[model samples]
Target: MTVDHVRSLSSGINQTGVRAYNERLLLSVLQRNGALPGGELARRTGLSPQTTSVILRKLEQDGLLHKGVPVKGKVGKPSVPFDIEADGLFSMGLKIGRRSADLLVLDLKGEVRMQLRETYDYPMPDTVFGFLERGYEDLMSALSIDMRSRMCGLGIAAPFELWNWHELVGAPPAEFAAWRDIDFSAEAARITDLPVHQVNDATAACRAEHVFGMGREYRDYVYFFIGAFIGGGIVLDHAVFEGNQKNAGAFGPLPVPDVQGKPAQLIDLASIRALEVRLEADGLDPRQLWQTPQDWSHLEAYVQPWLEQTADALAIASVASCAVIDFEAVVIDGAMPATCRARLVEMTRTRLSDQDLRGVIAPEIIEGRVGNNARGIGAAAGPIISQVLLNRSAALLGALLHKLGSERTSPFPGRTYPTGSVTGMPRAV
Candidate 1:
C-alpha cells in the first residue's frame, strides 16, 4: 500500500480502557508493513510518541517484540526498528484430511518450527486424536519451558461435515458416523490446557495464504485449494472471508462439466482422490501422492490428464466466483507438486479464455505461494491471530474468530475492538 493509504488506515486511539486495542494496533501495523522505528510506527498508527514508546518497551520486555540494530542516517538520533520476536510466542495447527492428517508447530512469524505427518486410507477419530495426542507431547517436549508457556493455543482444520465424505473415502458408515458427535474444541481440551480453535480445512489454507503468501497483494480474491477434495476459501477486503458458517469458500460443490460433458460439481472432476482412483484403476500406487519429499515425476504420464481436467473446472469456478465478488485474482494452490501447481495455473489461464465473460471481468489466475500442507500451516495460525494479533476483517466477520477455538485469551489482556489498524486480512505475525 502507498504510504498515504497506509497512514490513512492507522487507528491508534489511546484511552483509559483501550490499552488492549493500542497494543494490537502496533502489532498489526508491524505485521503488515514490517518493522519500523518508534516515530514512523507512531505516525503510521496515529499514536503519540510517548504512548508508542511505552507500548513498544512493554511489548519488548514481555518478549512479544525485539528491536533491530540501530541505523544512523543523515538525521538526528540513530533509530532502531522493532520487529515481532519470532520466538516470542508459539501456536499449533492440526489438519485432518480424507487421506492423511498433519500436525505442525509455528512461531509468531508464521514459520513452521516442527511438523509431523500420518497417512491412512481413510480417517477415524481415534486415529486422529491419537496422532494429536502423540504429536502434542513430542512437540511440546522438544521446546524449552519458556516457549512452551508462550503457546497460544491449537487450531484445527477439518471439513465442515467430515462424516459426509464417508463414501468418498470408502470408510464404513459406523466409522465415519463417529465424527457427528466429535467436538474439536472439547477433544483438544483433553490433550492440553491451551485454548482450542477450529476452521474448515480449506478456509485454513486460504488463511495461510492471506497471512503469509501472495493473497496480501489483493483486497479480494477467491482461493481454491486442490487437496484430497477440491475445496475453497474466499477473501474480501483483504481478509479471508470465512462466511457466517465459517464455510464461505466451500467451492467444491460449484457446478462444472464432467469429462463426458455431463454436469458435475467441481470436486467430482478436480479432487486428488479422483486422480488416486484413476491411478489405482491402472495399477499405479496412489500412495505416492502423499509420500514425503514428494516427487511425482514417475507419475507424470498419469498426472497430465488429471491436471487438464482439474484446471478446466477451476477456470470455470474462478469465473463464477468473480461474477459474484469481482475478485482481483483467483489463487490456485494445492497439496501437490510445485510443478503441478504452476502448470495448473497456466492451464487454468488458457481455459479462462474459453469461458463466456459477457458480464464478468476475468480475474488473474495465479499460483499460490504457500505450497503443500498449507491447510495445517493456516490452521496453526488461527489461535495466534484470534488472540494476540489483529484481524481487520473481523468487522465484516462480526468477531467470529473466537468461535473457532474453545476459548480466546489475549497475552495482553483488555477489551479488544473488532477491527484494528490493519485494514484488511488478519495479521498473523
Candidate 2:
C-alpha cells in the first residue's frame, strides 16, 4: 500500500489509450493523503513537477480531480491543492445476506449516496433478483443523467458457500440447492452494463472499514464481521488481503473454548444468528434481530448474555489471528447498530484480558465505525477502486479476473455496453 516512485509517463485521459499507471498512482496518493498541491503531489509520488502538473490537469479535466482552496505558502505562488472529486464517479454495492439484502450507491469519497434494503426469511432467486431489478431501476432513476453516466460498475458482497448454510437458515432442500448454481456477479451483469465484481460479504465489510473507516489507522489488522454467521477479513500492509482462493480470513471455523472449556467454532458462539437462536428458544420474536434501523435495546435482556459469549469468542479469535500475523490491531465490525458494536468492542477488550496469552502479543481491539451498512459500502468500493482509484488488492482482482478469462482494464471490462435489465438471465432448474 506504500506509494512508490514512478517516473516519466504521459497519456492524456481523452486519448484512446490505457489510463497511465502514473495517473492512478497520483490518484492513489491524493486518496490516501487528501488534497495536496502539485509540488507536494510530485514529492509524494516521485513524479517530476512537469509530469505531475500534466497528469493533474488531465485528471481534473476528466472529472476525477478538482481544485481546492488556495493556500499561501511561505514563498512563491499561492498553490492550489487538488482533491479527488467526490461526485466524479459512482458505483453500486450489493450485499446479499442470508436474512436480507442491500443495494447502495457510493461516490469516489466513499460516501453512500443512496441505499435500499429488503429483509426476507431466506434469499429466494426470484425475490433476490426481483429486488435487484427494482433497486437498480430506482437507484439509477434517482441519479442525474450525468451521475448515471458516471456510474462505474456493481460489486457484490455475498457469503462464501451460501448454499451450504441452508439447514442453518431453515430453508427447504430444493430452495437451498438453487444457491449452488448462482453466480451473483454474472446475474448482476445482466442488469447493468457496468462491470460486476464479487467478494466475500465479510471481506467486503473489511474493505469498507479499510477504505472509509479505521483502516487508515493501522497497516496490519484482523477484522471480524459479526453477521448471521461470524466471519472475518485480513488486512496486510494496509490493504484488504484475500488469499489464494479469496478466503483468507474465514474466521467462522476458527477454534475457541466454550464456557465449559470445550472446543467450539467461532460461528457457534459469536454470530448474530446465534443470538437469534437464543431469542427463539425463549419464545421472543427472532425476526426483530434482522430488522433495519436496528435497536437491540428492546431485546437488552437477551442481548446481554449473547454479547458476553460473542465477546469471549471474538477475543480468542483476535489472539489466534494476531498470533500468526503479528497484527497491530483487531478491527471488529458487524451488521449491527453502533451501540451493539461499541458494547461488543468494550466487552471483547475485557474478555481479551482474561485469555491465556502465554506467547502471542494480544492486539488492540478497535471498534468499527461503518456499522451494518459496511458490506454494501465495501461492495461499492470494489469497482471504483479497480477502475478509478488504486488499492493493493487491485492486483488480486486482476488476477481473479484473469482466472475468469477477462483482462479488463477499462471502464467497461468484458462487455462494453449496457444490456439493460431483463426479468432474468441464465439459471439452472
Candidate 3:
C-alpha cells in the first residue's frame, strides 16, 4: 500500500483494503515463524494457495521478502522458504526521558542500528529541538541514500505535560514550563522528512514489550516500568488499551501510604527518584544509578527500604488491577539490573500472597524482558505499527498471531522468577 492509503486506513479498516491486509498477514507470519514455503504460508494464514503465491510474488518484487534455500520435499518439486527482508523498512524512535533524550533507528525486524542519547538537568525547548536536529543529521549521514529514503516515520515517547513534574525532578519551573507550549512531535517532524507519532513514555515502553518482548506470549497483562518515575501501561486483547483519556496505565497516582503512614501516590514510593533521594541524603552521587544496571551493586542498604515499600505498593496495585481486568500476568521492568528486577518480582509475589485476593484471580508477577530499553524501543515501534500493521486491515492477522503466540523460542528464555532463573520471565500460558 502507498503511504497515503496507509495513513488513511489507520483510522479504521474496510473491505476495500483486504489486499493490503493479506499482504501484512503473510508478512507477519514470516516474521513470527522465521521462514516457510509458500504452501505452508497458505496453510498457516488460511489463504488460498493461489492467493498466497500472488502475494508472495508481489512482496518479493517489492523487496519485502526473499526466497531462501530450497528444501527437498517428501514428493513433488522442492519447496523454497520465503523470509522477510529485514532491511525493507526502517523507523526512528525518539525518547524524551526526564533526564535524557534518546534517538534510535530500528529495522523491519526491530533491531537497533543507530542510537544517540544526551543527558541534561532539565529540558528546554531549544535544547531538545537542537538535539533532535543534530541527532537526525548524524543518523542520516550514517545511512545510504537508498536506506534513508525507505524511512517509514518517526515516533516520539515522552511523559505528557512533563512540565507538571518539574518539582519532583528538581527542575526550574520556567525552564520546564517551556515544554507545556511546545509540541515535540511536531517539531521532530519538521526536523525530519518523515511522518511523526507520539505516545506517553511508559506506554511506549509497554508497546515495545508487546511487540518485541512478552507480548509475543501473553496477550493480557499489566505493565509497570520503573524509570525516574514509576509508570504503567495495559495490554488487553492483544493491543495496548490507552483508555478514554489515554492514561489507562497511569498507576503512579494510585493511593499508597508512605513510610510515615501518610497517603501519597505510588510514584512517590516506587520510583527510581525515590531511591535517588535516599542516596543523596547519604552523600552519594545519584548519577551512578542512571548510568547502567551494574552501578547499583553497592546500593543494597538504600534500595532495601524502597524495595519493601515498592513491593507492597505493587502488590496492592496488582490486586486492584486484577479485580477490574482479568490480566494474565503483571510485568515489571526498570532502569536496574536483571538481578534487581528478579528481587523486586520475588518480593512483590511474597507481598501479594499476603493480600486478601478474594474474588480476584491474582496475576503472576513477571519481570519484563525489555527492561530500561523499553521506552526507546517501544517508541520506535509506534510508527511502524501505525504505518504498517494497523494501517493495512491486518487487525485480523494480529488477532490470529495473538492466539497462536510465539511458536519459536522466546527472546529471553528460562529466566522467570520463583524458579530463580536470571535469564528471563517465565512464558505465560
Candidate 4:
C-alpha cells in the first residue's frame, strides 16, 4: 500500500480507541529498533503470534508500516520484516546551545530530513524562542508538510542548568542572570503552539546514542558528552533513567579531588573552557589552535597533561557512579569529531587500566557513533516516541477496561448486579 493511503487509514484509527493502542505499541517498537520481523515484535511485546499477525496486518493496511524484502536465511524460511514509512509522520527537534541553535526535521524512523543551524551573538530567552519558531516554520514550509494533524510535537534539548533551572538552584546555586528564573516550556509552547518536550542536551544525546548508536551493545553504560561543557547520561537496563525530577545525568557538577585534595567540579577542570584557557596561556588563539596545524602541534604538547587530568577526574566519577549504579561500561560522546573521540576514549581506557579499585569491574570507556547530531536528532525523536508510547498505554488500558466491563461479576465484595441491570447494586437481593 502507498504511504499516504496508510497514513489516512491510521488517522481514522487515531481516536478509534483500543485498536489505536495496539498500533501505537507496534509503531513504538519499530521507531526504537528500526525494522524487525513480526516474530521479534511478538517476542519483545509478549503478544501471541496470532495477535502479532493481526496487528501487523492492520498496521500495514493502515499504511503505518510497509513490508521489506525477505532476507534469505541459511536454514529456515525467510522472515519478512516490517519497517516504518518515513513519510507517514514527521517531528521537529531543536537543540539550544550557549553559542548556537540547531533545528532538525526527523521522520518516524528518526532519520533527519532537513537541518538548519543558527549561531547567536547573545541568546536571550525571547530571541531564542523567536528564532526557534521561525526556524521550525521555515523547515515545515520548505518540506511542504501540512501543519494540521501531519506534524508531531517539537522536542528540545538545552544545557543542563538552563533546562533544569529549578534543580540547580536547590543544589549548587548557579548565578547565570538569564537562567535564574524562567519558564522555558510555557514560553516555547505559547510561541509555537506545539507541545514541547524539554530534555537536557546530554540526556538527549544519550537517548539518541542508546537508540541509534553503539549504546545498544551494553544495557548499563554511561554516555559522556564533551562539548563546551562536559556532561553525561546514565543508561540502566537499556533504559535512560531520568531521576525523580527528570534530572539524572548532570555530569558537570560531579565532584572530583584536586592535587591538594580540594573538591573541584568536573566542568571547572575538563570542559572546552579549560582547554581554551590553557591554549591562551601558551600564547595561542583558541580558535586558531583548533584550525591550524602548527597550533595543533603546540596544542598536542599540552594534550597529554590535559587528557591525563581529565581522564583521572572522569575515572574518579566513574568509580563513584559505578559503586552506586553499577553500570557495565561508559560510552563517550559529544560534539567532538571522530578522531578526537578516539583520542578521548584511548586516554580514558588507559587511565582506567591504572586505577586500583578492588572487586569492581572497570567500565570499558568507548566512543559513540552519533557525533554532534546526537542531541538534535534525539530531541526530534522524543515527541514521536512519547506520543507512540502514550497512545499505546491508553489503548491497552482501554482494552483491559473493556474486558473487565464485559465480565459481569464484580471483583469487589460489596457489588453484584442482575443481568441487564442499570443499577450497579443487586436487584432486591
lDDT of all predictions: 0.81, 0.80, 0.76, 0.68
RMSD, one per candidate, in order: 9.1, 11.0, 9.5, 9.5
- Candidate 3 residue pairs that clash: 415-424
Candidates, ranked, TM-score: 1, 2, 3, 4
Q: For model 3, how does the per-residue alpha-carbon lDDT over 140-204 read when each residue is reduced to its tens digit?
A: 66776556656777888889678899898788887778888887767886677567888899988
Q: TM-score, each model?
A: 0.88, 0.87, 0.83, 0.77
In angstroms, give how far residue 228 of model 1 lies from its true place: 0.4
Candidate 4 per-residue lDDT, tens place, 73-159, comes to 898899999988776566788887655678888876667888887764334576677787677566755654342244667789887
- lDDT tens readout by residue for model 2, 316-387: 888888778799899888978788889999999999999888888889999998888889998999888777
Candidate 2, clashing residue pairs? Answer: none
lDDT for model 1, please. 0.81
Candidate 1: worst 10 consecutive residues by lDDT?
9-18
Give the alpha carbon lDDT tens digit for every residue of 1-429 in model 1: 332322222111111122366788788777767789999887767677998999999989878899999999897999999999888778889999988999999888889999999999899999999998888877777777666667777899999899999998899998799999998899876776567888999999999998888877887889999998988888877777777787888988889888789999998988898889999999987988999887888888889999999988988888888888798999999999999889999999999999999999989998999988789989988877766666645344444544432234433365232323344433211
Clashes in each model (backbone N, CA, C under 3 Å)?
5, 0, 1, 2
Which segments of model 2 are wrong by more than 4 Å?
1-18, 394-429
For model 4, which pairs clash? 6-62, 6-63
